[model samples]
Target: MYPGVNMDMEMQNVGSNGSEAAARQMATTTGNGEGHTHRGPQSAETGSLLQAQCNGGSVEMKSDRRVLALRGPQDSTICRMQKELKDVVCWKIPLWMLLLFLLLIMVAIVFITLALCPVFHQDVDEKFDPSTFNISRLFKGNFSLLDLPFSDDLLVPSSNQSRALSRDLQGKLTVVYSSSPALSRYFSKAEVHAFRNGSVVAEYRLTFLMPEQQEEQLRRFTLSREMVYNVLRQSLHQQEDHGTYIDPLSLTLV
Candidate 1:
């Protein structure tokens, strides 16, 4: 071999033997309970790298916390907006539903008013009908009287010879006379005295029948007998004065 080559070969052999010896010493120290006691350059470098990684992790955790904190306000805003929208929706009503609700309220108010209010009933009086009265049919009956004038020639002489006169006057009025001797005494005496004086005296008991159910007319008939006598006397006087008589058929009492 050449000298240079021999020198290079020796250097390589020395390097290999040094590395082997260092590995053997490390293994022996680990076996003898001296592991992790010696801090080498590699261990120090590895510790620095691990500390940098831990600092990066802490920075990322702080950024995450900042993001979560910022998101809290956004979340609250969104919740508030949603609540407002729900409130608006709850207040809204359809037109048909609103109208129906108003109608129901009106009906309930009417029902309550009807239940509380009072009701009244009124009565009416019947009216009187004057056309139902028949005057001709009422006077068609037999009645008793005496001492009415028949004619100038037919004069009654005595109480025993007094006759009951049944005569229809003017085809509508009927005059009747009852023959009672006791009732005719005063009229007979008056007739005899009037015959001596050359004048005829006439007297009468008169009753009028009316075609009505009125109590007022019956009351007048019962209370005012002089009124009837005056009316007859006036008629007879008018007949004597004018030589004309009013028709009894056309006369109406009421």
Candidate 2:
């Protein structure tokens, strides 16, 4: 308390006042707060951290003392959150692209499959002619009525199928055309009777005359060679006792 005091006295005075000064500082502060007291110049690490967090304002992490002191404020939290989000999206981008690629592939496959529907052979049309009959050619070609790559015989005509040829004939696949004016080169009647063992149990026919007005009418038929193939095939189903009367359209689209 006195001026010009000796060093020892000054030291003793400081020690005595220390306790009172601490109590007064305490009275000036609010003890109910969660964080610890901040009296001295904070370390660089803690100061910078606090300022950065303060820039983004405060946040209450469960309103705990430990959280306020350790976690600091919201800016660092937002920065950390942003970093984590960036990491997650970076990893997710490839997966998103992969899923998109897979979906595209599936769509392409479906489109291609629908486009190739006629490849399984659309229908059978046959013609029989004793005069222009060719036994060897018709039997050798695909037995399938569908243009698809399969055994032609597998496609059993629907119940409404008409038959023109007899059980008596057998034939092969051959190109038949001539300038004789009596017979064009495209197709001929199949004299299946030439074979003793071979026989015609059933016949099939597909409608080929495209609708006058329809989308892809000519395209569909021509795409499968159905137009020309059906013409000659129609004649074979017209055989005597073959019952050319087509039953009700068995496989009606509608």
| Candidate 1 off by > 4 Å | 1-198, 210-217, 221-223, 240-254
Q: List candidate 2 stretches off by more than 4 Å.
A: 1-93, 124-254
Q: After superposition, how far is residue 123 of candidate 2 from its true place, in Å?
A: 3.6
Models 1 onward score TM values of: 0.19, 0.19
The prediction achieving the highest lDDT against the true structure is: 1
Looking at candidate 1, the ten consecutive residues that score lowest on lDDT are 188-197
- Per-residue lDDT of candidate 1, residues 1-254 (tens digit): 59999999999999999999999998998966755776667766555422123311321223223332123455667777666545532258545456668899999999988876744333232234435433321111112222333453335433232332212222112111112221211111111111111222222223333336754664465224444434433453344323223333233232
What's each prediction's clash count? 2, 41
